[model samples]
Target: MSMPPVKKIVTWLLVIFLLYAIFTSPSDAANIVGSAWDVIANGVANIGRFFDSLIARS
Candidate 1:
């Protein structure tokens, strides 16, 4: 609410924004992979749920 505290908050916010911009630049890259693993994880979860339902009904 006071002037000094408001100025400090604005300065800190500016510093954080600059740091984030430096990290996420296009020069960095990733080794890409297919979505097969995602699909497999989902499939296993579905199978577990199916068995759980069967046991619940018995």
Candidate 2:
């Protein structure tokens, strides 16, 4: 199966924009990535805590 043309175009545009952002302002990019990582990590931690509480109740 192949991706639709519009989806492919949007993906390419996003890639180009990311590259431009990285090259134009690396510090801002780093901060953005760090923030994204923190969000993901906190989400995973919350999920883990939820399961822990579930198991503790059993």
Candidate 3:
């Protein structure tokens, strides 16, 4: 049997993604924000560590 057309497959995937996001896992969206903040925090912390290492070298 032939597979569904690409447009139909994309639409169905989007529909499923939206349904899952809206109904079953709303907080999952918030984790994206949390992940961004975590990355920011780690970047700042790494910069601080690098500066501290420079001071130690001096």
Q: How does each model score on lDDT?
A: 0.73, 1.00, 0.88
List runs of model 1 lying over 4 Å from the truth: 1-34
How many backbone clashes does every candidate have?
0, 0, 0
- CA lDDT, candidate 1, residue 56: 100
Give per-residue lDDT, candidate 1, residue 37.
Answer: 65
Which whole-number lDDT from 0 to 100 does residue 39 have in model 1?
A: 76
For model 2, give the RMSD to the true fold.
0.6
Candidate scoring better on TM-score of 1 and 3: 3
Worst 10 residues of 2 by lDDT: 1-10
lDDT of 2 by residue, 1-58 (tens): 9999999999999999999999999999999999999999999999999999999999
| TM-score for each of the candidates | 0.43, 0.95, 0.54
lDDT of 3: 0.88
Q: Could you tell me how far off, in angstroms, the CA of residue 37 lies in candidate 2 after the best superposition?
A: 0.2
Ranking of all candidate structures by their TM-score, best first? 2, 3, 1
The clash number for model 2 is 0
Q: Which 10 consecutive residues of model 1 have the lowest summed lDDT?
A: 25-34
